[model samples]
Target: MADEVGTYEATVTVTDDEGRTDTDTLYVHVEARDLPEALLSGPGTAIAGESRIYTLFGNAGDALLSSALWTLNGEYQESEDLGGQSSVSLKEKITFEKPGEYRLNGTLADEAGFQAQDSMNITVWSPTAHLLVTLTDTNSPVNESEVLEVDATVENLGQAKSDQPVWLTREGNVVDVIPGMELRPGETADVTLEWQTDPGDAGTHDIGVHSLNDTDSGEAVVTPGGGGDVFFAVGYTSPPPSTVAPGETVQPTVEVTNTGTATGTQTVVMLDIHGTPVESTEMTLSPGESRKVTTFSWTPTVSDLGTGDLVVQSEDDEASAEVTVQGSTHFDVEFASVVPTNTSKITPPGPHDWINVTVNVTNTGDTPGKQDIRLTRTVWPPKPTLPREQKDEVQNVTLDPGESTEVELLWWSPRTSDLQSCDGETKCYLIYTQLGIHSEDDEEYKMPYDRGGGGGGGNPPCTGPNPPPDSWCGTPVTLFSASEIEAGDSVGVSVKIYNHYASTEWRGVNIKSHHVSSYGPGSYKNWQAKLEADDSAQPGQKIKVCVTMESWAGSHLRSNYDPKAKAPAARKGSFGCSTIPVVDGGDDGGGGGGR
Candidate 1:
């Protein structure tokens, strides 16, 4: 039984009848009992339009193999299925027109009535395909329910052409669609879409354009208050503390722009979930004017752990924004030591001195945390408001449950003015170090400290009061901060105005005119501080004034404002201005551009 499937010899003796007298030897042949084995051989992988060889390894055990069969995917194959010789070898050459997986099989049967079969898989690969989508110039503020025009560009970067359809969606809903139209390799095309939102579509909406394999998206929002030639568009909304902790209050604001020729009043409202009103603010805007209105601050409780809408409305127009209310765990951090080293200084205490402060922080809280360290130098006494301040911060400092780390922050010196003099021979600058603990999960926890005074330990010599005997003491005008904005946009400027009258206190003092670059000192429309109203300063006192500037000209600008000075001699002070670079953009025709 062990020696199977082969020819065997058998012997027989004719002495059975006589038992011993006559003995005859006879030989007999034994047939093989094993079946023929069929083995199929072919490449496991191939490219479309390429030819591959498939062979059948066949054998019959001690017997002739009379029939050999070939099949593919359960279908029978002819003798010359691949234009090859029909023999026991059964070799075939095949080319697949399409890319996919296929099975090749072969079966062999011997004359002894036994058969065997074998199979193998072959894979075909097609060319590569890549699709890309792009959105351009989506930075302009869009109003709700208004017609928005956008261009979606599609490009094929792969070797194959695409016949898929491209779909454009807004807020997850398909708004526009286009056929691929067979884009060749490295080909690109643009599809323009004109989309108009429903009147009730007043919130932020994301628009996306996508193909089967790629996608791109941009965001837009609509504003409220529009009817009969007057339209108020909500331009922007910023939700502060995008993520908030439980029982925490956050201030959020909504900005609206008037794109009409006349002035109008609009009402903006904010609401939490459950149809409860939060805050409402009324704003009057002139033609081409845009104003930001702040609603009542919102406090989110533990039950408000999800997302809610903060809606703003004006007349028939409406806009809505999403505010996320989240909960978090508490953590704490401590400041161990704060050491400051002066690396460089200007003789007159200019604004560019390099002062490095090294701070040692420890995670004293129960849970591990990351700390935020900030160093600030501000002037005291709001009367002589040196609006200027120098600040630096280390954003994130990591620590273990009981670990400690040291970090460094840099600050520059504050600018000095002639009207403001140091109380002593040295000028006084108040230093403060603040430690904040914030996590991905919760709001920030803060600890504050007044680190005492700086400016060479005592006080750096600062410009002091000079009595008016000769041409009113020269008042030093300093530009504190100015917002660098894009061309065709508006910015707020903070300037320190000093009182220079020796014997007289100026009343009804206001910023009369201002200039940006060589553009204007035009009439004032909207300002943060109204000096002519209830605000005033003494002879040695300085006040901070915030002036908003707008220009359509695309260039860097410097701000200079002239204060209403009673005495002609006090007006001789030269005003220092800071340069703000305006980004490039054509006029949007919002009508707020400087004339």
Candidate 2:
């Protein structure tokens, strides 16, 4: 089956059917044959005086008649009948137990009278004798006062036993000589060496073992001598500056220094602001070596304040130190302002009239803060007058140190007799500023607005003329329902947008109901509105811009006004409008119109 050039032959035999049989042979021609090459199965070279096994195989052309024969230096010794085959396998285990060169020959014979032969050269190696040693100990970074235990293991991997003396030494000083110890071939021994390490310097030291082997010697590192005669002081660096604001982290660095002549190991520990140990680590310092050992970092929570400390201690030696940490200051407020002084504007008859109030905020804290402030105006004594309901405005602001900013608060009253009649009477207007601390970033300081007595009897005395038509004004917009909506049901909404100013500055009006997706202005072309009235309005009911809104049950009405354009030169008055709740399908009609 091999591709290498080799000879092959076929053998044939003839036999008769008689009680006795006679055989005849046909000789088949064969090409030149190749001998089985000899190969050593073990290592190429063996140790001198050591025994080894060598296996050999012979390759021939035909398996029926091939036999293998082997010779050493041209002298035949073994022959194997390969069971009538062209290839044969042979084995020879020879011991060049001594160091020297060896030559071998192998040959194969085939039935076709073909013969093949091959030879090989081999070498034997000598054995080397030497000793191996290692050191073992549990104590590391030894302290000056600690007992240093040094142990060694010695092994002989040579032809002869080692009758050598092993000695432990430190800094060129002999400590102990292991006497009467002899290690035979493949033998091992353990030796213990104890020394009270008192090197006067605090740093690294050298200690080792020496083996005297007749005329040769070997050395190995045994002990790591640190912490000489000096003592190591364990302590942390100064604590990081404290009084830090919330969300800030501080890291304090610690160091260990050897003040004595000996080198030793030390343990460092760090404690958080609450006196709780947060970190611990081990460190080794050499003589005169000052190692910055540990670091402690702390991040303060929103409710945390004041001072803290970090403590470090040495485990090998009883020594400790403490460092102190400090904390930061914070402050915030809500400020409110009303535009068009209360004593300067007249009350309008409709809810389309609007008043502008500004809420100012500031951060007085040593650190910055954020805030969410809301502005709202509510009418006293609940009644459906004009756009009767509380109006809300919200703002979020961040303030820096001593910084302040203002947000505008808007309100619209529906055009109705009840609201107009109570303007300077039983119904008092309240500008309520709900100041909340959303975060530490707001710039306004809030004051109490609900006490009723602070800003002048809760009502402004009679003021100036009613606002002109050219100013910004609003109309009644309402969302009504038949009953409280339940889960999984849709309801309808109605919206109304009205113009109440004396002068006509607006081209048209637009109404949008957030709860209902569809909304727009009336489609009348160039229709002049003058002295208008919603004849459909009922007693105790106000005129409201209405529309049908469809929504899932439990939904509330959210509506807003969007002007078609800036107020025109003809209309210059500011008006207020209110959001009202009404019947689901009733016409919220009524109003006075002017053009």
Candidate 3:
């Protein structure tokens, strides 16, 4: 039997039992199946001209997979089994000889008559080059006359080889190269170079290293020499001797010379007296040079009585010299006394009227020397009355070594009623005699004596014998008052003028008073008064002068006592007055008068 569209059937009978027949029908319907999807691919990037490892992956969507394979730039590179799965992966190691873009693909297959394919983009690039250099010195800061050594290192970090030359130089002088060889990729080399330095001025110098490729260079610094040792001698010349008196001044000179090769500057110059330095100065000296120096002066006093030594020294070099000084001795003369022996009167009157005073003169020292001895007598009022003028008489004599002489000095005091009755009560006349001895050395020795009443009382008559006719004569005059006064006060001074000689002769006379201590702070003018008289007046005459005090207070008085005496007479009588208290805005009173 057959169905619609296309059918076919067949029937059969069995032979033995009942003969029955059966039939069957057959039908057919026809359609096609879908194919498997293609495999997916990706693009690739790489470092150019280098070996790189890469992996490839495949995907076959809804297909029964059997095996997977990879291809680079249209060549079979690798293959992997899928094991009845739908995806596969493959790995490959590739080396690009040139740098550019390339293509890679993957393929997959299955047993069901299905197949798939995938592809990707690839790129390649070139590598970069690196070079490094370093320089080193084991011993640095090289001296001027020393040898200098330096070491250098060079390295290359690229894939290619290098043949660079490394050079060394000092102060622009070219030196040796580093092994004169080539260096491959990833290679390093060390080079050592040496050079000697000549002696030069002390300073710093530069050392340099250079490579031929201009990519490696280095520099270093060095230096060079300095200080050492130095010698001296000094001497001095002795000074000449100098003569100096006890109270005189003398300056001495000394010379110093530098005798060494080196110049020396002022340490010190010492001037000494008796082994002790009294003064010092400084000086500078050059080689073989001499200097004359006036160090200092020496003045001898009474304490420096004997010989002494003056030494000069150079304190820097300890050089010294000595000089000598000498001293002398002195002698002084004095007259002790001059007294008469008897009170008898003479027939022929002597030049002097009064009795004698025997004089005794002595040389105080033992040295024997000639001297002109003079005896002088000064009478007050400076003029004469009656028989003779009150003049100063001088007589010359000689003395032996350590010897004394006794001579007579005579004077006359006329007998009068007023003088004789008041002899003890009245102020008598005084005579000042000074004995002086002169020598060729111009040295003078003076001895002054006083004969008068004590204070204001009169002196007694002479009771000794009359002197010889040729004896020296002396006159006596009295000083009654010489005293100080206050401001605006009157100053009256009285002195008795008398004659002591037997003959009547007139003599010119003058009076002077030196106000040695009566001055104030400023300059002072001299105060003077004068008087005149003849010898025919009376046996004694009175002379008086007045002084007026100024209006300021001073340290000194208007009158002074004898400077040589321990105690002197006081100013008294009407010529003297008590100190007046200085009053404000009042007129000063005048000083009292004296008889």
Best-performing candidate as measured by TM-score: 2
Q: What is the lDDT of candidate 1?
A: 0.50
- Mind giving the per-residue lDDT tens digits that candidate 3 earns over 342-404? 234222122344534344555553343444433333222122333212223334445544666
RMSD of 3: 46.6
Q: Which stretch of 10 consecutive residues in model 3 shows the poorest summed lDDT?
A: 550-559
Ordered from best to worst lDDT, the candidate numbers read 1, 2, 3
- Give the distance in Å from residue 254's predicted Cα in candidate 1 to where it truly belongs: 54
Q: Count the backbone clashes (under 3 Å) in each candidate.
A: 15, 107, 21
Off by over 4 Å in 3: 1-241, 247-250, 264-273, 282-284, 289-292, 315-336, 343-595
TM-score of model 2 vs. true structure = 0.27
Which candidate, 2 or 3, has the higher TM-score? 2
How far does residue 77 in candidate 3 sit from its true spot (Å)? 99
| Alpha carbon deviation, residue 216, candidate 1 (Å) | 31
TM of each candidate vs. truth: 0.19, 0.27, 0.26
Clashes of 3: 21
Query: How would you encode candidate 1's per-residue C-alpha lDDT over 1-595 as one tens digit per residue?
Result: 4344445555554555657654455444555455567788888988766888888877676566777777778787745322222236777787765456788887876666667889998876656655667886453355644566678787775569887666555665444445444788778888775454434456677887776656788887666534424456763466555566667787767787877666655444454553344555556677788888764577877677777665555543556666677543333434443333332421223444454545556655434455555555443221144442334554576666466666665654444442142345333322222233333333332212121112222211125544222111112322323323333334343333222323222112224454432211211122222122112322223233333222111121011112331111111122233344443334553322321
